[model samples]
Target: MRFVSWNVNGIRACVKKGFLDYFHKVDADIFCIQESKLQEGQIQLELEGYEQYWNYAERKGYSGTAIFTKIKPLSVSYGVGDLDTEAEGRIITLEFESFYFITMYTPNSKRDLARLDERLEWEDAIRTYLLQLEQVKPVILCGDLNVAHQEIDLKNPKSNRGNSGFTVEEREKMTKLLDAGFVDSFRYKYPEKTDAFTWWSYMSKVRERNIGWRIDYFIVSSSLADKIGDAQIHSEVLGSDHCPILLELEQ
Candidate 1:
C-alpha cells in the first residue's frame, strides 16, 4: 500500500501549478493534503476511483485538510474526540479494516508565537486521540505537522532554533507523540540523512536554495514499522512551498 502526504498551501492555487499532473503520475492509494484553505462548494476535483473526504474550515480560506483514497473505509470521522478544535477543520479520520487513517493540519504558531499555547493544547488533545485509536488498531497519521522535531530535520538548525516551528515546546510535543507509539517513516528509513526537507520558505531564493524544514510527515504506529517498504521525499515536485512525501508498506 502507498500513502502520500503534501501540504498544497491552497488547492486552487496549486491546481494551476500542475498539481493534477503530479497527482495522476504518483497514483497513490491514499493521497492526503493539508492547508487546503478551502470551503465547501469552492472546488470540485474529478478524481476517478478515489473516495474523497474533506474537513473544511468554518472560516473561508483558512486551514483545512482532505484525503483521496482508492479503497473505501468502513467509517470516517472529523476532528479529534470531543475537542472544540474542529472549528478550523484540521483533522479527518478514516477507519479501515486494519488501520485508522488520519490527516491533520497542525495549527501554526505565528511568527510572534501568538498561537503557541493553543498549539500545545492541540498537541495534547491529538496525542490522546491518537492513543485512543491505537487501542483499536494501528493508526496511519500524516499531514503538515508544522514542527521540525529535531535539528537535523531542517536546513539551518542553529539559526532556526526557537522559531515558531522549531521552538522547544513544539518539538517536545512531537517527541512525546512519537514516544506514545508512532514512528516517523522517513527518519526510520534514513536516520542520518540531512538537507532533505518538505516545507520551504516562500522568501526570495529560499526554495531555490533548498532552505526548508521537514515539517510534514507520515507517522505510523510503531507496530507497523516492519511493514514499511520505503519512505520518500519528492523534493523535486512543486506547487506549494511544500513538496509531497510518500510511504510504501507491504500489504
Candidate 2:
C-alpha cells in the first residue's frame, strides 16, 4: 500500500499551483495534508475515488489537517484526545480494519519560543494517543511534526540548535516518541543519509541551497517496520515550503 503526506501550507494556494496534477500523478491509496488553513465552504477538492476527511481549525485561516483515502475507513476520529481542546484543528485519525492512520499538524514553538510549553504538552498528549491506537493495531502516523529529531535530520545543525523546531527539548520529545514503539520510517531505511529535508525556509535562496529541516515524517509502529518498502522525500514537488513524503509498505 502507498501512503503519502504533505503540508500543503494552504489548500487554496496549493490548488492554484498544480496540486491536482501532482495528486493525480502520485495516485496514492491514502493522502494526508497538514496546515490546510481553511474552513468549510472555503474551497472544493475534486479527488475522485478518495474519501476526504478534513479537520478545520476553529480560527479561520489557521492550523488544520486533512486526509484523502481511497479505502473508506471503519471509523474516523479528530484530534488527540484532550489535545483537541486547543482549537487549532491539528489532528485526524482514520481507522481501517488492519491499521490506523493519523495525520497531524503539530504545534510550532513560535520564533520567540513563547509556545514551547504548549507544544510540549501537545507532544505528550499526542504520544499517549498514538500508544493507545498501537495497542489495538499497528499505526501509521505522519505529518509536519514540527521538530527535527536530530542533527542528522537537518543541515547546519549547530546554527539551528536552539531554534523552535530544532530545540533540544523538542528533539527529545521526538526521541521519546520513537523510543516508545514507533519507527521513523525514512531514518529506518537510510540511517546515515544527510542533506535530505522536507520543509525549507522561503528566504534568501534557502530552498534553492537546500538549507532545510526534515520536520515532516511518516512514523509507524515497530511491528510495521519490516513492511516498509521505501520512504521518500519528494523535495522537487513544491507548492508550499514543505514537500511531500511518501511511504510504500507491503500490504
Candidate 3:
C-alpha cells in the first residue's frame, strides 16, 4: 500500500499549478492534504474511485485538511474528539480494517513565538489522541506537522534554530511523539541524508535554492516499521510551498 501526504497551501492555487496531473501520476492508495485554505463546496474535484473527506476551519481561508482514499474506511471522524472547540479542522481520522489513518495540520508557532503555548497544548492533546488510537490498531499519521525535527531536516539549521518551526521546544514535541511509538518514515530510511526537504520558504526564490524544511511527513506506529518499503520526498512536484511525501508498505 502507498500513502502520500502534502500541504497544498491552497487547493485552488494548487489546481492551477497541475495538482490533478500530479495526483493522477502519483496514484497513491490514500492521499492526505493539509492547509487546504478553503471551505466546503468552494472547490470541486473529480477524483474517480476515491472517497473524499474534508474538515474546514470555522474561519474562512484558514487551516483545514482533507483525505482522498481508494480504500473505503469502516468509519471516518472529524477533529480529535471535541467537535465544538475543535473547529480549526486540524485533524481527520479514518478507520480501515487493519489500521487507522490520521491526517493533521499541526498548528504553527508564529514568528514571534506568540502561539508557542497553544502549540504545546495542541501537541499534548494530539499525542494523547494518537496514543489512544494506537491502542486499538496500528496508526498511520501523516500531514504538515509544521516542525523540522533535526539539523539534517533544514538548511541553515544554526540560523533557524530558534525560528518558529525549528524552535527547540517544537522539535522536542516531535521527538516526544516519536518516542511514544511512532516512526518518521523518511528519517527511518535516510537518517543522514542532507538537503532532502519537503517544504521551502517562498521568500527570495528559496525553493529554487533548495533551502527548505522537511516538515511534512508520513509517520506510523513503530509496529509497522518492518513493513515499510520506500519513503520519498517529491521535491520536483511543484504546486505549493510544500511537496508531497510518499510512504510504501508491504501491509
Candidate 4:
C-alpha cells in the first residue's frame, strides 16, 4: 500500500499549479493534505475513484486538512477529543480494518514564538491521542507536523536552533513522541542522507538552494517498522512550498 502526504498551502492555488496532474500521476492508495486554507463549498475537486474527506477551519481561508483515499475507511473521525470545537481544522482520523490513518496540520508557533505554549500543549494532546489509538491498532500518522526534530532535518541548523520550528522544546517533544513507539519512516530508512526536505521557505532562492526543513512526515507505530517498503521525499513535484512525501508498505 502507498500513502502520500503533502501540505498544499492552499488547495485552490495548488490546483492551478498542477496539483491534479501530480495527483493523477502518483495514484496513491491514500493521499493526505494539510494547510488547505479554504472553507466548505469554496472549491470542488473532481477526484475520480477517491473518497474525499475534508476538515475546514471555522476561520475562513486558514488552516485545514483533507484526505483522499481509494479505499473507504470503516469509520471516519474529525479532530482529537474537544479539538473539533476549537475550529482550526487540524486533524482527521480514519479507521480501516487493519489500522488508523491520521492526517494532521500541526499548529505552527509563530515566528515570534507567540504560540509556543499552545503548540506544546497540542503536541502533548496529540501524543496521548496516538498512544490511545495504538492500544487498539497500529497508526499511520502523517502531514505537516511543523517541527524539525533534529539538526539533520534542516539546513543551517545552528542558525535555526531557537527558531519557531527548531526550538529545543519543540524538538524534544518530537523525540518524546518517537521514544513512545513511533518511527519516522524517512529518517529510519536513510539516517545519514542530507538535504532531504519536505517544506521550504518561499523566500528568495530558498528552495532553489535546497534550504528546507523536513517538517512533514510519515510516522507509523513501531510495530509497522518492518512493513515499511520505501519512504521518499518527492521534492521535484511541487505546487505549494511543501512537496509530497511518499511511504510504501509491503503488502
Candidate 5:
C-alpha cells in the first residue's frame, strides 16, 4: 500500500499553488493532510476516486486535518476517545480490517511556549491512546507532529534548541512515544539522512538553502516495521511551507 502525508498549511491557499496537480500526480492510496485551516462548506474538492474525510476546527480558518483515500475504511473516528480534542481538528482515526490509520495535527506551543503544558498533555494522551489501539492492531499514524525530534531532524539544531518545535520537552516527548512502540519510519530507513527535511521556514531563501525541519512524519507500530518499504521526503514539491512525505508498505 502507498501512503502520503503533508501539512498543507492552508488547504485553500495550497490548492491555488497546484495542490491538485501534485495530488493527482502522486496517486497515493491514502493521502493525509494537516493544517487545512478551514470550516465546513468553505471549499469543495473534486478528487475523482478519493473519499474525503475532514476534521474541521471549531474556530474558522484554524487548525484542521483531513484524509483522502481511494479505499474506504470500515470505520472512522475523530480525536482520542472522549478526550477534549478536535476542537481544533487535530486528529482523525480510520479503522480498516487490519490496521488503524491515524492522521494527526499536533498543537504547537507557540513562539512564547504559552501552550507548552497543553501540548505535553496532548502527547501523553495520544501516546496512551495509540498504545491501547496497538493492543488490537497495528497503527499507521502520520501528519505534522509539530516537533523536530532530534538534532539531525532540523538544519541548525543548536540554534533552534529552545524553540517551540525543537525544545527539549517536545523532542523528549517524541522520543518517549517512539520508545513506547512506534517506529519513525523515515529515520528507521535512513538514520543518517540529514538533508531530508519536510517543513521549511517561509523566510527569505530558507527553503532555497534547504534550512528545514522534518516535523512531519509517518510513524507506525513496531510490528509494521518489516512492512515498511521506501519512505521519501518530496522536498521539491511546493504549495505550502511543508512538502509531502510518502511511505510504501509491502506485504
Candidate 6:
C-alpha cells in the first residue's frame, strides 16, 4: 500500500500548476493534502477511482484538508474534539478494517509567535486524540504537521531556532507524539540523511537553494514500523511551496 502526503498550499492555485498531472502520475492508493484554502462547492476535482473526503474551515479561503483514497473507509470523522470542529478545517480521520488513517493541518504559530499558545494547546489535544485512536488500532497519520522536530530537519538550524515552527515547545510536542508509539517513517528509514525537506519558503531563491523545512510527515504506529517498505521526499515535484512525501508499506 502506498500513502502520499502534501500540503498543496492552496488546492485551486496548485491545480493550475500541473497538480493533476502529478496526481495522476503518482497514482497513490491514498493521497492526503493540507492547506486546501477553499470552502465547499468552490472547486470540484474529477479523481477517477478515488473516494474524496474534505473538511473546510468555517472561515473562507483558509486552512483546510482533504483525502482521496481508492479504498473506501469503514467510517470517517471530522475533527479531534469540540475545540477544533469550527475553528479551521484541520483534521479528518478514516477508519479502515486494519487501521485508522488521519490527515491533519496543524495550526501554525504566526510569524510573530502570536499563536504559539494556541498551537501548543492544539498539539496537546491532537496527541491525546491520536493516543485514543491507537488504543483501538494502529494509526496512519500524515499532513503538514507544521513543525521541524530537530535541527537536522531544516537549513540554517541555528538561525531558525526559536522561530514559529522550530520553537522548543513545538518540537517537544512532536517528540512526545513519537514517544507515544508513533514513528516518523522517513527518519525511521534514513536516520542520518541531511537536507531532506518537504516545505520551502516562497521567498526569492529560497526554494532554489533548498532552504526548506521537513514539516510534513507520514507517521505510523510503531507497531507498523517493520511493515514500512520505503519513505521518500519528492522535492522535484512542483505546485505548492511544499512537495509530496511518500510512504509505501508491504502487503
TM-score of each candidate? Answer: 0.98, 0.98, 0.97, 0.98, 0.98, 0.98
Span of ten consecutive residues with least summed lDDT in model 4:
81-90
lDDT of 4 by residue, 52-164 (tens): 99999999899999999999999999989954424989999999999999999999999999999999999999999999999999999999999999899999899998999
Report the lDDT of model 6 for residue 61.
92
* Residue-level lDDT tens digits of model 1 in 1-251: 99999999999999999999999999999999998998999999999999999999998999899999999999999987778757999999999999999999999999999999999998999999999899999999999999999999999999988999999999999999999999999999999999999989889999999999999999999999999999999999989999999999998
Candidate 2 residue pairs in backbone clash? none
Worst 10-residue lDDT window for candidate 5 reads: 79-88
Runs off by more than 4 Å, candidate 3? 83-85
TM-score between candidate 1 and the true structure: 0.98
* Candidate 3 lDDT tens digits, 1-251: 99999899999999999999999999999998998999999999999999999999999999899999999999999887653425888889999999999999988899999999999888888889999999999999999988999998988899888999999899999999999999999989988989999988789989999988899989899999999999999999999999999999996
lDDT of each: 0.94, 0.93, 0.92, 0.94, 0.94, 0.94
Q: Candidate 3: minimum summed lDDT over ten consecutive residues — where?
A: 78-87
> What number of backbone clashes does candidate 3 have, counting pairs of residues 3 or more apart or in separate chains?
0
Tens-place lDDT per residue, model 2, 1-251, is 99999999999999899889999999999999998999989998889999999999999999889999999999998866656543888889999999999998888899999999998998898889899899999999999999999899999999888999989999999999999999999999999999999999889899999999999999999999999999999999989999999999998
Residue-wise C-alpha lDDT for candidate 5, range 1-251, written one tens digit per residue:
99999999999999999999999999999999999999989999999999999999999899999999999999999989877786989999999989999999999999999999999999999999999999999999999999999899999999888999999999999999999989999999998988889988889999999998999999999999999998999999999999999999996
lDDT of 5: 0.94
- RMSD to the true structure for each prediction, in A, is 0.8, 0.9, 1.1, 0.9, 0.8, 0.8
Residue runs of model 4 more than 4 Å from their true location after superposition: 84-86
TM-score: model 2 vs. ground truth: 0.98
Task: Report clash pairs, candidate 5.
Answer: none
How many clashes (backbone atoms < 3 Å, residues ≥3 apart in a chain or on different chains) does model 2 have?
0
